[model samples]
Target: MSANGLPTDRLGGNYFKLFGASTISNLGDGIGIIAYPWLASAVTRNPLLIALVAVVQRLPWLLFSLPAGVITDRYDRRTLMVIANSIRAVLTLGVALIVLGKQGVLPSPDDIDAGAVIGTDGFLYGMVLVATMLMGFAEVIYDNSAQTFMPAIVHKGNLEKANGRLWSIEQVANTFMGPPLGALLLIVAFSVPFFVDAATFVVSAALIALIPATKRSAKQTDLVERRPWQVELKEGFSWLWSHDLLRPMAIILGLLNMLGTLSGATLVLFAQEVLRTEPYEFALLESGGAIGGIIGGWSASRIARKIGSGPSLYLTLLLGGLTTFLIGFARNWIFVWAMFAIFMFFAVLWNVITVSLRQSIIPNELLGRVNSVYRFFAWGMMPIGAALGGLTVVLTDAFASRDIALRMPFFVAGVLSVALFFFAAPKLTTERIEAARTGSG
Candidate 1:
């Protein structure tokens, strides 16, 4: 038995290794969460340009998710994870070098918040865009494969436990530990965080590589005739679309994601201009999510059981709007931090229930493709939302104060989320979810 009183034998050695890799990589992601936006703000103050970086980073979900699903299904998933992280390490290293070369000319983070104007380095900004896009591609592969890879290492019964613990630790590393460290690194130099981020990727890649290969034997591969990519893709899509529950679930998630990015795309600016947060304060603000996520991750299963999956989801949607709307009106960082904590709590609740459901129901062979299609619908809208977020600020700025323009996205997102709750309430019921699970078995 583990310290938590759960049977350690069930989780297995490989799961821990995968867990370690995820934890390390997420810490880097946590650091990048601070570093990337701070770096963007230093490059330019234009809300649209800052939002553009977000759009480009998420664009791969829109453009590459389907193909990546196919790739995940075809390749050895562990190898795919290793290769993706290795590529990210090299790409991040290149970013560190580019930033190092140009750090002498870029405005300091302290200066940017004070309304200092700096001419954008076209080369550096372009590199940032290119690097983000590539990293996003790698992320798509790594994330999809990782999700599919989970069932291979751990039993289906323990998925929620495994995923919950995994996400909890990831949140701790990404939000709690990473952001503060990133803030300190930023104090030293812009290049320092990127270099550290690269190292994390290297370590994560090595850990994943150490896992035993999950490859099918030649006879197993030969037994199933390989179909064309288009056929396989269609099979995945058809299965998801034909399902009454999943089709709507995917659409509702897409809208929710869209609304999320609507406010989040320009949040760095809002923090700088409206909330008046410095790097340390911003890092502190992010830590709020970690606290919420830790609690949520540890308790999501209990919450779902107590309230039912459907009601849990409803709570997520309702709170999403409420928290975002509240955040828009706050002038203080502490208030925003509180809202972030609430927002992340329900966010993790939604993820724990839904992700575990999908993992439990989907056939292992098609899990990669179906999950990809699901994400394509769910995540593809982010770039569109990001673009709209930037446009909201620009258009609102024309008629309103900069502060109000920055706040508009949150108001708009909040309203949309409440509206989404009404639509989703009917489709994603407890009965439907249970019925689907029964039917799958």
Candidate 2:
């Protein structure tokens, strides 16, 4: 529904402001996601090392994620967001300066890579890694708090719409502006987008500071004789494990994540080895999915209503897997590109639906810890999938053609996705969440 049609009584003013601020902050990160990874790939050709860039970036979610959840629960989430964004702004400023140096201050491609940065006598790869790690750390903190906080600001009825809008903004940030801006920034002034990104965070911090934190309910809130931090931390994890409904969903998301990452890692190989495309052209092929992601986010709410959230998840997940397999068999660049685009459309559509469904169904008190638990495994295995995808390429290359090596992962994930549907969906019923949402149980 349009903003005009929705009754003002159902949507709180503070909630809209909070989500709007989030959309802007997320847009900056989206640009960085494209810029940072491609920048790493361009300067360093080593597949394993390039993959390390993604690992170090995501590693924070594994290590600090649990602690971030604890902190989010104990403190003011609005203030926490401001602090996190401020720290990221400082880090982005540092990275931008380094880029500026590369453009002029260093003045020599000779000093670019191995001199002061990586110490390999010439690689800026080390600095790039540091920048990604910093941003990743900031993201972990911001996300943990936001997950918990957003649910508090809005009423139960608008939860799905709120989450869908957040995903939609992210789609624009990551998929829409990230590619063209990242590509153009690299060509014209590599440092420019980094500076602009830093500025966005600074602006986000300023805006977030204006909002007041949510008040906790003393009656319903848990009280512990021991230190609150210790209690809060364990409570989050305990709630997730003990809950019959959430446990299954968490496990399913983790397993699907592994499948998703496996397909993602193999995309490059498919484009380069199977389609015989250059890196730039391959990047374009990948960007087509980003477009699909944007479209998917826009449609998530309507689709969820039509199909119900659970069935929407099943169909999209299965369709994505089948199309991915078809992509592996495509004989030419045009066909492969067509398959990749459709693959992304379905994959992203699945993601938008599943994510909103989970967010809508889960308890707010358990949001941070549950999300962290979900991230710890769901996201924790991403690097492994990437590494394994690379390994499959390597091992397969040793025996078979590069095309076989590249397409192998697609087939594996296709099978996994299908299995997840059969094994998990029948058990995940709408009746399970109704009690939780109604609070009558």
Candidate 3:
């Protein structure tokens, strides 16, 4: 049986193990979403610093993603996943311990607006930053391995189904259930959520280790091993570049990610300052996106089938742009939650189709390398976006009110996303999708 209660034969028993591992890990990530920013906010009220914490977490994608791809291709992906999760467990435990030690001094959610605990100490912030960086490093390998690992366990036709289920569970774990749990944990004790997350990673790693080994080619591994890393890296880059649809998609996604992060990086401050969200309310705000993600995940295949994949993909860009643009104008937290939900809904839809397409299109031998290269471009922009988010607020603060400065990133991202729609719509035609589907690309 599987998550959806379908027979294991449809997706394979190994996929179920993968799904379980993803659920546990995503739950930990959900907790971190609350725990890291909450801890950061407790340390300082500087929007730039808050955003920098977010930046460091994503920085590994830029620095290590390509190499991660190479390793994913060469190794047993299951082993890599287990190792990555184990390391995450340790790093998260360190964070938990630090939080436990410092609970007496850390600020409550109420003190965030009062400026009482602001700029108190750098030691705790530095510790949080280091832990975040290490955890992110592990995530790079774990996520890369997980993506490549999926195609091995499920048949090509079931890629969409598998991805949809995986994404659905992850959203539920990370966003829906995780945030509220984090909020409650924070109310009880700051250290509790981190400790709970550490335990989840341990369980996640164990689940992954239980997965049976899938096939890998010794000849292919030898071929990759024989080549210089530069050559292997080039092969991945060249493959993506030569593919007309994938090339443009990666470029556009990279741009969108940069712009998206630009707005998203300062969300903690926006929620605190502009929306006036308390700790529990802030957690609920996080859950709003998860609600949409859950719906999108379940309906993705159906919607794509009804609308056609090209239009479905186009809809993501159009709706995501419009919703994000609207978020900039929101004065109320309820409005913010609504817009975030809508944006995430489209985002998940985009992910379901695109991820399945990539898995189905890329050859097994080259999947890891090509996927990594694609992410190197696609996700590599996140750190830059995170920095831009913080800078936009800080620089804009010189002239504008703090609230207005916080809104700048959302406005910029929205405008760029809308502009991208016109450029992408024509290029992302059904004919091109068919061409890729038929391997004509």
Model 1 lDDT tens row, 69-94: 88888888999999999999999999
Q: Determine the C-alpha RMSD for candidate 2 after optimal superposition of all C-alphas.
A: 4.9
Q: Of 2 and 3, which scores higher on lDDT?
A: 3
Output the TM-score of candidate 2: 0.83
Q: List the residue pairs that clash in candidate 3.
A: none
lDDT of 2 by residue, 27-62 (tens): 677667555654554465454565566667767876
- Tell me which of candidates 1 and 2 scores higher on lDDT: 1
TM-score of 3: 0.96
Alpha carbon RMSD to native, model 3: 2.7
Those runs of model 1 whose alpha carbons end farther than 4 Å from true positions after fitting are: 1-9, 215-225
TM-score of each: 0.96, 0.83, 0.96
Deviation in angstroms for 188 in model 2? 0.2
Q: Each model's number of backbone clashes?
A: 0, 6, 0
Lowest summed lDDT window (length 10), candidate 2 = 107-116
Cα displacement (Å) at residue 60, model 1: 0.2
Off by over 4 Å in 3: 1-9, 113-117
Model 2, residue 322: displacement in angstroms? 2.2
